[model samples]
Target: MENTKQQKTNVSSKTRTLVSAALFAGIICITIAYFLHIPIGGNGGFVHVGDAFIYLAAVLLPTPYAACSATIGAGMADILTGSANWALATIIIKPILVLFFTNKSKKIINTRNVCAAIIAGIVGTVLYMIAEGIMYGSFVSAFVLSLVGLVQPIGSFIVFVVIGLVFDKLKIKEMIK
Candidate 1:
């Protein structure tokens, strides 16, 4: 039937679109992680603009692809930055950071996204502290590390706002199709 064939075609097209978005987001996330970092922590914690892309991916793409993009892209950054052990944590943390974000609306600067960014900053900082504490074998030391890590999400929130606004103005999300 034509309807059945059209359904198949739609599915195929959507799959391609999602995959392409994921790949492009991953590449961009990697680039941001590599270059835009502020060394503000004592226990090897640093602020990076990578989470902006992660949030962007989550906002612009579906959950599966957005999580995948954040996980792989952020994981790769850890591996490349001599923080290989943190790769797994990054994979887990990056995706989880966007768990509360629902990209249901086309409005990028809406309430859902702002709340998402704020919650992401809080949860991301706590999660990193726990992970780094376990890795460093000291909860206290991890707390200190988290102080530095706090900058990441705060900085990311700022980046996410500016970037999201720009994307909206430029109709970047619409152009994806």
Candidate 2:
């Protein structure tokens, strides 16, 4: 009975910590995306490193929590930064990016995660291209604009790798677990 009670307490505590971390990650995502964005394309698109936090959240938190962090943070940034048109797409796409990663890994940076990041980048780019094509009613224009869009995923991958290395060295995933 005592052990069971202790287990419950631990679970409750971990849940609180994870929720708090997700909230914090969301805020970081918004701050980086809104404040540090570089405007690109005529459709109010920009490239930002905010996705790094989303990637980190994916490798650290559970899937649902990571998805929430990515969707809320990226979507809120779009809304707050006068790019509300992209908010819906952001909400839809960001959570999908989280699906490519896993928190079950013992280390933040690993071969599987490295592959996941690459695949996620490609998937994110394609999804955004489709979303933009649909929104603007011109797949050709979207394709042209996607040339610029490609920078984001590439940049995000670099940022994620750098940050992931540091987090791995610090054993942040292990500590969180």
Candidate 3:
């Protein structure tokens, strides 16, 4: 009975911690995406470091939690920043981005994650092109315009790798788990 009670307490504590971490990650996503962005092209599109946090969240949190964090964070940033047109697309794409990543690995910068980042970047760019094409009523134009979107993933990959290295060195994943 005592062991069971202790287990319950541990579960509850872990739940709280995860919830808080997700919320914090979401906030950081919003902040980085909204405030620290470089306007690109004539579209209201911008490149930001927010995806780095999304990648980090995917590496650290469970899939569901990471998806939620990425979706809410990226989606909310779009909505709050008057890019509501992209909000729906972001909602759909961000979670998909998380699917390419895994928190199962002990090291954050493993082969799977490296490949996942590259694949996620390509997939994300393609999805954004499709979304923009639908919105603009021109697939050709969207494809041309969304070329700038590739820069985001490249930048995010750099940020993720650098940050991931620090996190791995510090054993942050083990500590959190």
Give a tens-digit lDDT track for model 1, residues 36-91: 76655455456787887788888878788788888878877777777677787888
- Candidate 1 clashing pairs, residues 3+ apart or interchain: none
Q: Provide TM-scores for the models.
A: 0.87, 0.90, 0.90
Order the candidate numbers by lDDT, best to worst.
3, 2, 1
State residue 118's C-alpha deviation in candidate 3, in Å: 0.4
Which 10-residue span in candidate 3 carries the lowest summed lDDT? Answer: 24-33
Q: Which stretches of candidate 2 lie over 4 Å from their true place?
A: 1-4
Model 1 residue 131 distance off true place after TM-score fit, in angstroms: 0.6
| Model 1 local distance difference test score | 0.79
User: Please, what are the lDDT tens digits per residue for candidate 2 over residues 1-177?
Assistant: 999999999999878767766685666467556656888788977888787778888888878888888888888788878889998999999889999887898987888888888898888888888998999899998888788877887888888999899988998877775
The CA lDDT of each predicted structure is 0.79, 0.83, 0.83
lDDT per residue (tens digit) for residues 1-177 in model 3? 999999999999779767856775666467556656877666667778788888888888878888888888898888776678788999999889999988899999999999999998899889999988888788998888668667888988998999999999999988886
Candidate 2 Cα deviation (angstroms), residue 14: 4.4
